[model samples]
Target chain A: MNIILFEEKEISSTYHIQITDHRAKHIVKVLRSQVGDRVRVGVIDGGRGMAKIVAIKPKFPFSVDLDIQLETTLPEEKPVIDLVLALPRPIMLRRILSQVTSLGVGRIFLIDSQRVEKSFWQASLLQNEQYREHLLIGLEQAVATRLPEVSIYPKFKGFMDELLVKDLDDYSALIVADPAGTNTFSEALRQAGGSLRQGGRVLLCVGPEGGWVPAEVDQFSGCGFSICTIGERILKVDTAVIALHSRIMALREIL
Target chain B: MNIILFEEKEISSTYHIQITDHRAKHIVKVLRSQVGDRVRVGVIDGGRGMAKIVAIKPKFPFSVDLDIQLETTLPEEKPVIDLVLALPRPIMLRRILSQVTSLGVGRIFLIDSQRVEKSFWQASLLQNEQYREHLLIGLEQAVATRLPEVSIYPKFKGFMDELLVKDLDDYSALIVADPAGTNTFSEALRQAGGSLRQGGRVLLCVGPEGGWVPAEVDQFSGCGFSICTIGERILKVDTAVIALHSRIMALREIL
Candidate 1:
C-alpha cells in the first residue's frame, strides 16, 4: 500500500495511533520492516500519515510512531466516475473491481440482473473479503490512498427502489452501456459536458452476459439514463468500464 | 470459443481431422454433444469451420460432418499500435492478454526489465500453448478473429539484441508509459498525429512495478521513444494498456 489507510477508531490520538490488525501484521511479517524505516500511511476519508518503524520484534508485535494529519482528499481535479454493473461471472467480477478502482472511480455498485446467473452470488471469492483484496491491490497500484465503497444488491428492482431513484442526487450524466444503444459513447461524452476538476458525477451501467432485457432497458431509460456504445466490438464488462472511463476522462480533459 | 484455432500440424485432410487433446475433452465432456448439434470451429491461420455432430458414443469416439471454410475474413486493418510491456504477475497476465487483444493491437512484446521479478517466468501460465488460451478469449470478446503472434525472449539483452536496433519500418510514433513520465495521454495523442488507420505504427511501451530505470529511458530515447503518462492517477499495467488503447482509438475515431 502506497498510503496506509486507517479508520477513525484506529487513530488513538492526533499524532500517535497503534496498528494491530492486518496493517501491523503486514508491516511486521510481509514487509519485514525494521526499526527506523518509514512507511507511508493515511486514514480513511482523512489525511495521510507517516509511520516510522520504532520497533520490530517479529511474532511478538511491532510498533510504529505516527506523525501525520493529511488532507488526503482525492485531488479535486479527477472527476468521480461511479459504475453500476450487472455482475458478471466470478472471474469477470475480480477484474472489474480492480479496473474500476484503478480508474479512480469514487464508487462501484454490483447490481443483479435477469441474465446474471444466480450461482455467481455463491462463489467463494465473494463470500469472504476476497473481492475487496483485489480492490486494495488496485488502489495501491494507482498510488491512491482511498478505496471505493463497494456494495452488492441482490435484485435490480430493490436497488432501484432503495438506492437509485430515491438516494442518488446531482448526477451530471447517467449512462447505460448497451451494445445496440442509440447514442455512441463519443456523442454521450460530448453531450455530458463538464470539467472533471469540478467534481461532477458520471454513472455508467453495464448489463450481463445476455445483455439487458427490453423491459430493463425501458426502466433505465425511464430513470433518465443515456444509452451508449464503444464501437462494434462487444467488450466484456470490465474492458468496457475502463474504455468508457478513459474516453470520458479525455472528454473532460482531466488528463 | 468464437473460432477454434488449430496448429498447422493439427490439420490433416481437407474435410476431416483427429479429435484429441484438451479441446477434445471440453467438446466431449463439458458440451455433452449428442448428435446433430452445430458447433463453430476455426483453424490457426485458416478460416472458420462448422462441424455438425453426426455420431457420438460416450467415451468411445465421436464423428462430425466438418465444413472448414472461411465464412468471413478478419479485417485487413493492420494494428496501428505495438505494445511493449514489462511482464506482469501470473494472475494479471490473462487480463493483460485479453484486454490488449480486445484493443486490436498488432503486436505484444512481453519483455523483462531490471525490476521485474525473475520468478514470473517460472509460472506455468507462460507456457506457449497455455498463454494462447488467454489471447483467444480476448479475441472472442472483441470479435476480432486474427490471432496475435506472441514471441518470448525471456532475457532483456536478448530482446534488445533481437528487435531493438532493427529498422522501425517507418513507424511514426514511439510512446512509452512511465508512472512519473512527462505529458498526459491527450497531449501525447494529439502530438502522435492521427491513429493507425492512417497508416502510422505507434510503439507503446509500458514498464513494470518498480518502473523503468533512467538507463532504460535513456536507451529508449536513443532508439526513438518518448516517455508519456495517462495522468497523475497511477494505473496498473493492464489498466494502462486499455486506457492508452482507448485514447489511440479515439484519436483514430475508432471509438
Candidate 2:
C-alpha cells in the first residue's frame, strides 16, 4: 500500500488516532515502521499528509498510534473521466475495480449488456457494498483519498434509456469502444468537439467480453456516442480498461 | 480465444491439421463449433486465415480435424516496441506476459533489479519456455500469429553491460520509467527525436514494485535513456506495464 487510509469516523480526536486493522499490520510488518517515524497517511475523501508513529505493539493483533497532521492546501484534482462498463465476471471485476481506481476515475457505472452473462449480476461482490473494499484498495495503491462512486444497473435498457438521458449533459463527450470502429479515440474526441483541458468530462463505455452486438452499437450511436478503437488487437476486459484509461490520461497531459 | 493458433510443426501434409489439446476443447465447448464451420486460425510466425472443421468428436478427449487455408497476403505487421522489465512476482508475471503480448511487443527482457526479489529469478515461468503458454494465450486473444521473443537475465549488471550495449544500435530511443521523472513520455520522445512512423523502434524499461534505486536510475541515465513518467499515480507493476504500453501505442496512432 502506498498510503494508509482511514475513514472519517476512525479519527478519535483532533490529532490522534489508533489503527488496529490491516493498515496497522501493514505499517508494522511490511513498512517495519518504528516509533517517531513518520509515514504517509490520508483521510478518505479528505486531506493527505504525514502521520508520526507514536506507539506500536508489533505483536499479534498489531496496533499503531499516530499523531495526524493534514495539509491545508487544496485537495487533489478530481478525475475528469467516468466509466460505463458492462459487468464482467466477479473475479475480473475485483481486479478492474482496484486497477481503475488506482488510475483514477470520477465514477463507475456497472451496467448490463446483452453479451454479459446473467450469473455475473448475482455475484456477491456487487452486494452490500462489498465492492467498496476493492475501491479502497485502489485508493491506497494510488496514494489518494477520494473514493469514486459506483452505481449498478442490471437492465441495459434502463441504463441507456433512463440514466444516460438524465446524465447526458454532464459529459462533454460520450465514447463507446469497439474493435471495428473507424475512428481512433483522438479522432473521435476531435469529431465530437471535446477538449479535456476545457473542463470537459469524458464518459467511456466499455462492453463485455463478447463485445457490443450490432443492435447495441446502433443504440450507442443513436445517443451521440462516438465509436472509437484503441487498435486492431483485442484485449481482455481488465487490460482494455487500463489501456484506455492510460491513453486518455496521456492525451490529457499532452493536449 | 478469438483465433486458434497452430505451430508450424503441427501442420500435416500441406493444408490439414488435427488438434486434440486445450484448443480442441475450447472449440468444442466454448466456441461450440460444428462440422463445416469455419473459424479463424493462424500459424505461429506465419499467415492467418480460415479453418473449416471437417470432423469433430465432441466427447471427453475431444478432437477436431480442420482444412486450413492461409491467405497469400503478407503477414501482420511486426511490433515496433520492445520491453525491458524488472522481474515481478510470478502471478503478476503471468498476467503481464499475456497482457503485453496482446498489446504487441517485439521482444521482452526480464532482468534483475535492486528492488526485485531474488526468488523471482527462480520462477518456473522463466524456465523451460513455460511462459510461452501465456504468450500464446495472448496471441489467441489478439488474433495474431507472430510470437515475441523472451529472454531472461538474472544479473542486472550483465544485462546492462552486455546485452543492452549489443542491442543499443537497434532502437531509435531508450526510455526508463520513473515516478519522479521531470519529463512526460511525449516530451521525452520528442527530446530523443524519435518518430514511431519512421520505423523507429522504442525500448521501454519499467522498474520493479519498490522502484529503482538511485544507482540504477543513474545507470539508466548514463546510457542515454530518457526518464519519463506516466503521471503522478503510483500504479502496481502489472498496471503500470499495461498503462505505459497503452500510452505508447496511442501516441503511435496519433503522432
RMSD of each: 3.6, 1.5
lDDT of 2 by residue, A120-140 (tens): 999999999999999999999
Off by over 4 Å in 2: A73-75, A192-194, B72-74, B192-194
RMSD, model 1, all Cα superposed? 3.6
Model 2 fnat? 0.77
Index of the highest-TM-score prediction = 2
lDDT tens readout by residue for model 1, A1-32: 55566666776755666666667777777677
TM-score of chain B of each: 0.79, 0.96
Candidate 2 - CAPRI tier?
Answer: high
Q: In angstroms, what RMSD does candidate 2 have relative to the true structure?
A: 1.5
Clashing pairs for model 2 are none
True contacts kept of 1: 0.65
